[model samples]
Target chain A: MRIPLKIGDAFVYGFAVVLVIISFAGMYLMGAKSDRRHVVIEMDKREIYSIEIHEGMEPVELRVDAGDGRYNEVVVMNGEVRIEEANCPDQLCVKSGAIRSSGQTIVCLPHKLVVRITGAGGEPSDVDDIAH
Target chain B: MKRYIAKACPMALAICLLFLPILQGCAINEVREHSKNLFALNTWINIRIYAGREGPKIIDSAVRRIEEIERRMSVTIKDSDVSRINDNAGIQPVKVHEDTFKVIEKALEYAKLSKGAFDITVYPIVQLWGITTEHPRVPTDEEIREKLKFVDYQKVILNEDEGTVYLQEKGMGIDLGAIAKGYAADEVVRVLREEGVQHALINMGGNVIVVGNKPNGQPWRIGIQDPRSDGVQQHIAVVEAVNESVVSSGDYERYIKDVYQKTGVRYHHIFDPATGYPANQGLMATTVVAENSADADALSTIVFVMGAEKGLGLVEQIGNAEALAVTVDKKIYTTKGFDRRLTVTNEEYEIVP
Candidate 1:
């Protein structure tokens, strides 16, 4: 069976195919951009460390001292960063579980400690504020 | 022909759907404006100002204003108004900056409103607890009682005409850690408004204040931190706001380490002036939403200390203010008016009807 195709139909089909290709390309680029996983630990607005979250890696526990006995124990395990222990009374840091997504942050205000997950350089350049 | 039209219609729709990202990208430059810094108020402050190209400059001025306020009010600074008041406690009344006088006046007003639940003159007791200092320790009942003698807000005599603040007691100290951040948020709002900024969000260490709605005319989502969660980002409730502040106080914000971890007793910074211990009326956290940030900041502590039942009543009594209390049992109770504005995200805590 032969089907007749009009010029309008041909235009529509070509446009649809082009649109799908562009959208997929855009999504792939975005996915790649967000794939660079790194978690940064900062105290008093100063960077203490940044570590890559490699999949299938053994759990690593890091103890950070904000001087004068203020300490936060950061744990990297199962592809996420979390505070395992902290000396601050409330343990708000420890309660803030693992964060794997970019732009997610765990702030221990008493110690002025911040654990932030980012994509490439630091927290995504896009988000202006993490209003919690 | 009709069948062909039907197929083309969906194809056209899909193409339009695919074009969304491009449209969003084009709109971004015109719509999104933000500025953030850590230098102001000794806390990380992030300002999202949705304005024209002037957003960045407005944010800079806002930060500068906050810094100026910090210099005026900080007790740590030797020459600050608060430092002078603390230094000259009972020695003499010290003149201060106009801003400092206004803040102290407002703090005193809150002290009267909450019946001393949110007293600024609790600095001596705060020092004794040492929650934020190097020598943090749970004070004995006797030590706390002795320090409580200086925790009277009535002793802080402010003469507005002379622009002087005097502490009546010899050893009285004043710390504005609770209310100053809120005042900073309000000042930033004022600065943004003066600069023709319509939409903005200013967060000074989680004392979030928003001026107007988002650039898109939607309410800004301010998350209430889960008091029980280990992650600070784990918000149990999300409240939409326009021209309001959301401030929370809990046992978690500042505390000496939980020495008896298994006993579940924690030595937090929020002290009850009457008892001179961490205000333990069985509240995990309290969030206040109000037009004035200072009220929100102070009431969060007031309500937390008062517990859920009395706290909710107090919030209701105060017009233009609402509160959410998270109890030690993991139950969430909000002011009657707050239910309409808040969306609870955590299932573990039931919202008290």
Candidate 2:
């Protein structure tokens, strides 16, 4: 196939070059963290850890920091996982979709609970997040 | 890698010599450093030569070949090869450039590998929603569900010898957005080999395909974005990719930002062909590393829309392709060897089943 040497092609190509130079040369805006795809947190009442996932299927286990109060309800739906019913009023964490990707999350603020997705591949968590 | 290049060079050299003056030295060509192919949608593209001599004119010829392909494959051009072929998807066997036909053939192969989980026919649904266009608006459920009737990849028909493509349905359209970049990355590899480019890094936005290693013999360092953190994250992770391709599709990349305060950003690009709107799946992003680079690009989008479980299932079933998913919960999950390639931080994230 022959490349058409029309004026528009030149103009457009020229524009792209200029744009590339400007963008690369210009101050680079802040970028997202490139490593560590997940994070887990342990609080007073229970232990919370969020899991980050990619395009696939695998069983991920979360050892709920069952302190004095127990983990009453647990549920998994779609690609997310969350507590279906809890003692907290907000129930905000449960209301959110099953914690699926690094972007989607569940937080039990009152329980000081935080479970999130983090880096590399999805490895399991059998230990406590905090010393307390 | 050396073994593969050694056996392939002799044939490439013979074909390259026929255009001798146009392709001298095969490796360090002066003209190749600059001569722009005015037609290949002017973008800042870098090519690495793999097989031929680096003669000045050969790089220009190789780049020009890419420009020619850009013309042949662009969907916006009415007279281009893709348009004519796509226009006749149902009525006739639309003849096309070998490159275009090759992409279709590969997409078909990937479709089979993914069990139709990744489809090219999603274009109709994409256009109907007008996600990337200025007229972006949420389409009704009925509208989306109705159009999804033709969103099957199996409907794509191909004749390899004749280089023809046909869409079984009249309204069914093909969107190369998912895989075109990867194919372009492959084309860069193709041209580099044709022009004898031994080492190169072709980064089309996030779709990356590297050759050999860096000039210093170090593996390329590719940083996957930290979704929680702002801007480009500080952490740089090393990846082992010589000739292979790395492609990532994430929710943070493209979104329909609100016109006013820029709140309520709608992620419209990763739509569920089944649902006809943005995929309601919980996944926020998906990235795939694979042999062809382009497959990684297209498959990543398909897998993202498929959600983690189904998407992971599809990846495992397809084989050769490994994925890393960051669910909304901030956990990172990946296929078998994917764990080995990643560097875990003290920061913790949940790993969903």
Candidate 3:
């Protein structure tokens, strides 16, 4: 075997090496998850209260449904790590909730309040506006 | 012959790779050009003053003066002029920095526009949720309800004539996270003008105030981050004319990771003050262009929480205000007559019909 590889081999391997480096760099840059904030609103269309969770154990948005007028029936539960929204008095849920994730929660109340959750910064559009 | 060529190719490849870093270094000047700040990182900002022979030095003095005003008038740090004024909110008539008072007053004005969707008195509510730091623990409903009692923008009383600010309720606090950067940008620009700087750009983080065009009479190109990418540049909006603030409110930055279990769920920082939660507005990000940075800064958040449709309506309702909103589905909603101003990255984004 020659100490110096042939030019053909060098070019082929060099291209492969480039591809690998690029892939590795991109993966490293993104890491497990770099910057991306996806605002996902999960709620039954019929349900008026939408809870938003964002990196906070506390519910981010708690909408109070003045129109519905059944807060007690609206139940908000933050248990262990998972928060759930159920029917109860305005869900005073302020308490009975479980948002297992950092920014997770449940809201049974709307008009009377709102609940929200945030995840690691995900890009829905142009995020550099503030991220610098 | 084959061996020599092979060896030469590797050397050439190495040279190219080595030069890659230097090529990227061109961004240093680019970064400085786009830096938006004259002060060092993580330090109280210092914008270069350039009015005339007396400009730079005078501007420096003026900015220093403004920092003191901000300290006394800021809603974040406790017991500044704003805190005391907020304490005596009901008493009426106290003195404050004209600029600080104006900024708070402006925040109040924004609160009115969004119908309280943009309130500065959201500190209690925000702190309860801990949007900025880790250990984000969900507070009790009772806790939120009780704290809600103290979150009232109306409680932020500013007497312009008396140069005083007051918080009507005890334990009530104001957090300018909503608009301080913009306000700071405005002050820095004003200082630059006073210092006789014919051309300068002051960017407090992403909140930017572009004074006059560059000395070469060229418009400054500002890159808007793609709402869907990370550490990537999106569309660039070039500002040729002077005296404009381009502030964007996107759903990125200041958030916690692993907050959701459903497929691809991430949380954002901007919260909707009305619900004492993050806003459900369909908009992923909102950018505002205004005569000053403060207006751009505050309005971006307001419109973001308001959503694309309603947010545009709010901007239109104000008259002379323009906005660009990017929806979660990757659609860009820009205002009428703004088409000429915005540069879309590709066909991926369409101006909302």
The model with the greatest lDDT is 1
Please give the ranking of all candidate structures by DockQ, highest first, separated by commas. Answer: 1, 3, 2
Q: Backbone clashes in each candidate structure, one number apiece?
A: 7, 82, 95
| Model 3 spans > 4 angstroms off | A1-132, B1-59, B62-66, B75-79, B85-95, B140-142, B233-241, B260-265
Assess the local accuracy of residue A123 in candidate 3 as a C-alpha lDDT between 0 and 100. Answer: 24
Q: What is the C-alpha lDDT profile of model 2 across B1-353, one tens digit per residue? A: 66556544653554444344333323323321221111233232434332323444555666666667678777777877667766887788888888788878887787777666667788778777675565666677788788898798888888877788888888777876677667877776786666556566665545667766655566655555444432222222234666677777766534554531265545557777666667756766677878787778877887787778788777887787888777877777787668688654426454434
**Candidate 2 residue-wise lDDT, A1-132, digit = tens:** 333456864665565556555544432331133243544433432335444444443645454544567442444433445566666533545654355443223445444454444443334322111000
Best of the two (1, 2) by TM-score? 1
TM-score of each: 0.75, 0.60, 0.60
Candidate No. with top TM-score: 1
Q: List candidate 2 segments past 4 Å from native.
A: A1-132, B1-59, B227-238, B259-265, B344-353
Between candidates 1 and 2, the lDDT winner = 1
Q: RMSD per prediction, one decimal?
A: 8.8, 22.0, 16.7
TM-score of chain B of each: 0.89, 0.78, 0.78
